[model samples]
Target: MQHQAFLDLRTTLDLLKANGELSEVSGEVNWDVELGAVTREVLRRRGPALLFSNITGYRGPQARCSRLATGLFASFRRISLMLGFDQQPSNRALIEYVLKKNATLVPPVLVEDGPVHENVLTGDAVDLFAFPAPRWHHLDGGRYIGTMGCVVTRDPQTRQVNVGLYRSMIVDRNRMGTLIVSSQGWGGHWGKYREMKRPMPVAFVFGWDPVMEFVAGSPIPATICEYDVMGGYRGAPVPLVKCRTVELEVPAAAELVVEGTISDDPATYAPEGPFGEYTGHVSEIATPRPVVKVSAITHRDRPIFRGTLEGSLPGASGENSYMSSIQRAAIACNVLRNAGIPGILDVFVHPVNNGTTVIVQIKKHYEGQPKQIAAALWGSNASSHRYKFVVVVDDDIDPGDYEAVDWAINYRVDPGSDDIVVFRSTFGSALDPSTLLEHRQLSELGAGLWNRMLIDATRTWRFPRRPQWGGERFPPLVTPRPQDLELVRKRWREYGFAGWKAEF
Candidate 1:
């Protein structure tokens, strides 16, 4: 991996542009309507994101700016680059990188000032509306500004840093209604402070390297601080600067920084959502979330507005953001390895409704053994407790290859013998539709256990058999000739493949 220090959002935009991953537009775009519509249309076509240069209703001369560059992490090639791996490295390779670097914790460095501190707007002068906030969906309650930003908070007792990528909806210029699922680590920290009747400090950072954005979404264990993990992911200490108005440190090169205090009181319930969640559905959750009375808003000159959609479509809540799913699978695989599972070749958790559903696969070692392995997988620290469904398969099956896993599921396993539903022990996410019940039903159920179904999709047998793994016993490997691939690259136009030409 190379060290590419981005000085500002413009530099990050330029890098995306130079890599042919950005779309440029010169028309007049509106933050309230046009920006959201265009992004939806582009994501529908699975097209590159556009940067809208001229937004409507500007105080100064109609400024040249662009929006929506590299939405949904766009490409696997880019994901691998972001993770510091080869173009097409396997999940195993990714896990190796994580384990190798996790021990050498690279602490973040503090700086006096960076791009984020360039133009500080303190107290009443700070207006979040000055920037273009996108109203992504028609049914969305409000325009969201921090879809791609990292919310930085720390434990009130331990002071362990927690970073999460939660949405920030613009309520007014000075106030944004943040969605906090209090069960989550970051939210739990705020809940603890709220119990003690103390204000929780928070700093949200927009527009840093995409790697930081990814880390913001990662499930870094409670013991390890995300800032340290961000440092590991970057292969260098992330440069952070202390906020002038809040007790928080933000990325020095962040395009925009928001500093505020979270009011920790359930009595202050705000009518939060009808906004689209990661699942393609619109749901309402009433929680006493942090009402950030913005102490300050800081940014560099001409800071680019960065965003992503989150409602059940590609680039929003869709499969377009497969990198995180892939990363989650990698994390699960690591957990299994730590548990001494053998013949674990690969794993993949695919997004259904884009990212709401998870399908996990593990290589089968022995006949009828896949059942035991499948059940044990539910105990794995990374995914077992949380995933909706987990399927176990043989090495003959490619977990990441959706087609192969489907074939195994259809032809091999009989549900009567292979499918087993374990009760009372599992936990699930709030986004799960089946878990939430009516108030009357809740009285009977008493907070239901999220029942996850694990289908032992690997081949079942009548008798014990040897594991079909190792050297030549593994499935025949296939790869295109380097010369042939190069030839196809040069002659792709003649072969009627336009996308390839654009890709190359």
Candidate 2:
């Protein structure tokens, strides 16, 4: 069966249910730590998507939208299904699919009306707590309403629109705060607005189509609008509706659209987080962040709130890490190929490491090719500086197979001769737990320096075979010949192993 673009969250959920990948929970749950705890357990067990029908302690307008959804993209099979693949795809296949689709840019189409405008609240009616916002983790400073949502921003000078996925905390009625990393797209826009001495007009969209969220979080080029990439993935223009208050356009079928202005006044800043981040740590301390003064709230009636469980163990398998890894891997591969780095076969960013470690497979054509690949990757635009470890292996080894990678590292590498290029004083991720308090303090002051290691595990060359290089035969690999392996595979069933299969 062919897969089509899902217009909204409900349609995506319906597809998951039809495929037997979703489960509904009728029991009333709390928006506090209880909901997050349950979701974490489910994600750990690789369980189905969850739909919480009843949420306790949420009354009045909030009670109308008591339903919440979580764990939508926990499995690779589910991700493949959402991406319109015929069957479950490997990480490399998924990355290649995105890379191919991303080559063509498709702009979004603007419309006058959408389900998000079903009810519009302006002025005093705009309450940030009207929905069931959850405190996803025990240590989080407050209830976050935008864990799975997209924040919209635009450059004042260039007029380039950017949609980014940043965690947001509800401060009060008509007020929210979001954490913008120093290197993110939205942060650049915010900096531009700050230089222009104007408040940044922004909108937070919740409960959009699954593909929309993926595009928002992916590390696309800064010049390309995420909406265009969304259209490319969907094979059609994404329908957008103008926000009631902000000048931005939001997903037409979004469940909620919060229009606001990020205040430039330092006095309006508030403590945003001690929340657990995707790096598997709660190392980020509570700090003052820019406040967003909400001007309007618009939503569909009885909307479903989508919440993502981020940080540490649960987040490793969560939507953000999974999608980011795929996009990063694709970007890393493209960067290497575009730079004319020869023999780069594949790249895999470990989901659990959150891009801190990357595995690269290459066909070694020369003696120093592995070191060259490692150096090229470190200097690429794929955020290689943040990577603590970059492993280079032969094309015969699968980068995603940890066992094979480990074997290559153990046997093919001699630490003395093989390169372990280490660079000190480089920018590191703020969420890295290994970062010392002193280092973090320095990083906060514009000196975010750390160390990076690159390991070359390619097979060593003992002697040169070419006459130009003083003709001496090189030792052959110890593995069985290709013909012998083919004979073994062909006679596997005939060898009295009826239910067994051989993997070559």
Candidate 3:
């Protein structure tokens, strides 16, 4: 598919509107739990991306920023459009497109300055609350300013630039407390900074084209810069401008840019979390984490703050859920290929689990292939927060279909056989409520622990071949012959089920 560049939020919104995928909520809406609740309802209904203009506390003429955008990726259609598809594409198509684009890296082009520098606020003049950062959940610790922020940072030694989607909450006008998992891309940078005992320079790009959020939020390999990947998606180099207060570059026309430095100093840490997470639960506790020492705030005039209601609830999934489904599956497949593992036909991640469970469909090349898939995934950085439950099925099964997977798991998997494997006490998501509290302690363990599981739902090769079953190791699936199905199709009304309007 040809790529179309929508470099900024304004143009992206225009595209969304033109495609009838956007909705402008001109009526006054509260930025508290109310807006979040409304957004959830829309997500449940699979509605359009919202442009909230008349927020209750942010609509005044003197308001620093009055508009906000959310739910741009609540559906496959929106994500498909972002990928330059004229219409909604199947998950396989989406994954294939992403795999190709990820390999096509084009580094960003830096200009002297851009619209992000149109207005700059520093020192006492800076007020993070001036923008309509929302307390998306009632239990949220504070107004999260960086729900969708594409955080930009670099390694001190290698100078390798990284852009990631890490959550940040407003602690004060100039201080934002954030969670930086040691297993993530930004966390790797934080570790080096800790060793050197220096503050880590950080730049938060709050809003831009949807692709920024797409790549930043996924595991796109640490060696490849996200900006380069973004450029590849746009079919051109991303225009960038140097941040005023940090040695970082942000998209030139980003809606808002928050520049800061985070010290490893324990004294500067602040309490954060108890917010809704993508796993469909509230982060259990408020723990003191690294806080950003905001040095400056730069943006275009009347900037629109970007954030998302993070949790994916029953029948109400959020942006991260939709985006992760395609990217994580593609990334997982890529990981297996890179590891030289064979017969990885396709991979699928259910939106609800947000990549926690990766379903693999393979051509069944050899015995113990399921264990190999689980091992490779668990050993990869892409499995930091996901791939906790890896299910392997034969090529006949559709990984995307829960029913087919369930059927395969029931029949193909022998309960007492070597079809199930569990790797205990491995690194995983700290916010997983199922994990014991003691195991989830970041202060002590530096990361959470999970007992990962692998279910080999493929037909077992251990079974003896039988001539009665057509010389197969396992019995073939029971179904009517092709001639019988065609006969029924020709005489459908005779079966007295013509009221059911479907092909035989």
Estimate TM-scores for all models: 0.81, 0.90, 0.97
lDDT of each: 0.64, 0.79, 0.90
Best by lDDT: 3
| lDDT-superior candidate, 2 or 3 | 3
TM-score of 1: 0.81
Off by over 4 Å in 1: 1-8, 58-72, 81-104, 285-288, 314-320, 351-363, 366-377, 384-386, 422-425, 437-449, 461-504
Ranking 2 against 3 by TM-score, winner? 3
lDDT of 3 by residue, 188-240 (tens): 99999999999999999988988999999999889999999999998889999
**Residue-wise lDDT of candidate 1 within 220-299, one digit each (tens)?**
66677777877766567889999989888888988888888777564543545556656556645543345776889998
Q: Return the clash pairs for model 1, or none.
A: 51-66, 51-67, 52-66, 52-67, 53-65, 309-316, 364-394
Model 2 misplaced regions, further than 4 Å: 1-3, 59-62, 312-316, 371-376, 384-386, 416-418, 441-448, 460-476, 481-504
Winner by lDDT between candidate 2 and candidate 1: 2
Q: Per-prediction RMSD in angstroms?
A: 7.4, 3.6, 1.5
How many clashes would you count in candidate 1?
7
